[model samples]
Target: MSEEPGPVPAAAEPTGDGLVQVAYLHPHQVSHSWHESVMRLVMYDQLHDARIVGTAGPLMISCGSGSLVESRNLAVSRWLDETPYEWLWFVDTDMGFDPDTVDRLVHAADPATRPVVGALCFAARETHHDGMGGRRITAVPTLYRPAHDPQGNVGFTTLFDYPENTLLQVAGTGAACLLIHRSAAEKIRAEHGDVWFDRVRYGDGRWVSEDLSFCWRLGALGLPVFVHTGVKTTHHKQVWLSEADYPRPGGGEAAHGR
Candidate 1:
């Protein structure tokens, strides 16, 4: 697609009570050969599914991680601030979410609970005692910890004691998948810069991790990210093994660019 910045008005409308804002992180991060078709059939089509329920509609934004987090993350943030919705779902290109996903996610959240602003965990964390604090929680075995884990060493939870369903202040949140409420995003942008995904390799703390720094900033502000264990969406990355590469019914092979 186009490389320009700013929010692209979604062709769809809201199907649910929540304002769904789907943002793609590092569309360029994946291998180009599978980029176009994957996005259209999977990412785009999935969002389109919500049209039946009025939970559809999102500002599609693509940005390179590092510096100018404000300009990047805030592009959508600004658009969202101008909108009337309360909850905003920030998704990467890898995410596969639909109306059912939205409906279920909202149900998973506690109505009596105050607003939470943290990374939504589709992948469940292993629980020992169970607790919630600082508005964050870490997976028992996070997808990344294994890669960095010592050979044969069972990695432990970075922070312990969290509620089964509650807002957790995690050390960092991944842009790969996160559901941010409008008030939460506004609070975050005011404190830190913008949402950084670390798409760029050659950068410092601010350059490399948007999700990471985002949680830190949100936690610092005491905004807990409400963890919805029930809601989850498939994440599609730019890779040969990605499920998004699967062909559509009655279709040929997936093309490179859309």
Candidate 2:
């Protein structure tokens, strides 16, 4: 016998213009900080003009042993197929950003120009000095430049020289907090199949992260990927600190490490 589907919840019912669909990489358990961030998102969605249709939960493959990267990719692709949203705003559960982060990112993402825009989030790593004695800042898997190996194959080099308080073109970046247009998502899925995110091995024999791999795909399609340096998000760790609150190398504000 065929089973009947359950009634739709009022919260899940369509509201507003259905222009954006927000999703996050949530695990079974989350921290207090993450809870606070989720609350902020909820409040922002209510007050914002761009109608966010829904916020989907995490995709669990097993009992807390699934690849979060692949899970997020699949979840987002499904949203693209099932929802009528024009944009997908992906935020990591542990990330902390301003309530206006989504507004700013969406404004910057002009469909005619920028199709993929990501916020700058610092990685949890030790700070070190570069060869020129300057402080080497580490971002979330941002590419420095393109490289060629002995076999004449090309690869990307990760870099830390990111601009502050401005938008800049990037070869690839992390997806801790990113806003992707529907056009770009559909294009990638049509050409690359459903596996939009995957680890790619470059000529240098190093594996590119999933986020970077997605960015590379966008770049290949002639879509410009940009980082809104002004929209910095906090990556939750043992000690919670955002890029805005973090101190710089010489006792100055860590505004995008500038």
Candidate 3:
């Protein structure tokens, strides 16, 4: 990946008559550090003419014993039903972005082209198998592009060498920081009911992540998901780290520092 920032396309100024209502939804826990990161973005980021709603403190209803998925689902459902917001921006507490992150994401989600846009963020996963007798760990970019096998089965993997500063169609992505249109949310609710985010079992009998499950539901309605690579975000795991600290896909360690 290039060390320099990618070129950002100019976004049109929002007219008074074209204001968009947006709810900044944060699914948080008891981490003060992450909470502060969320506050900084909410306080400083430019979100076009969006009227931001929601807060960084206890935004989700408690589901007892750290039910992250259920909490997020309840919060999103309430926002869709009670608020007139045209968009829902889900920013996990552990995620940080530039001041123009929201603006860039909104620009990418042009109603005429893209309805759902996710920012590029880092994520880590661990898998265990009795045959291996140990856990295998993998860390990579969560933004993904879809692919198919010769047998016609769909699959997803990180775009390790994707072109810079472009909008790429994705099968799904981690909702750590994503911009979603109300129209898509409404469609899912009307067809699948209020259970918006959760682990869903696919035909292969494997449980999909909550983020992918939501994307799959939207895909069923012909809505496409995209990742705006121009708008990069930092996943604040363990301690604060920038994009440079992220482990590359193939093999390499990023410089680690404060």
Q: Local distance difference test, per candidate?
A: 0.43, 0.66, 0.65
lDDT of 3 by residue, 119-177 (tens): 88788665443243544445688866566656666655566766577777777888888
Q: Residue 245 in candidate 2 has what lDDT? A: 45
| Local error of candidate 1 at residue 41 (angstroms) | 13
Stretches of candidate 2 exceeding 4 Å from the true structure: 1-18, 53-63, 126-144, 149-153, 238-258
TM-score of each: 0.49, 0.73, 0.71
**Candidate No. with top TM-score:** 2
Clash count for each candidate, listed in order shown: 28, 0, 0
**Model 1, runs deviating above 4 Å:** 1-17, 26-56, 64-72, 97-99, 110-114, 117-171, 192-208, 237-258
Candidate 2: 10-residue stretch with minimal lDDT: 1-10
If both were scored by lDDT, which would come out higher, candidate 2 or candidate 3?
2
Q: How far off is residue 71 in model 1, in Å?
A: 6.5
Residues 135-227, candidate 2: write the lDDT tens digits. 544434443455567789876666566556666667777787888888788888888877678777786677877887887788788877777
Tell me the deviation in Å of residue 140 in model 3: 0.6
- Write model 1 residue lDDT over 210-256, tens digit each, in one string: 45555545555765544443344454332222334367657866667
Positional deviation of residue 93's Cα in model 3 after best superposition, in angstroms:
1.1
Ranking by TM-score: 2, 3, 1
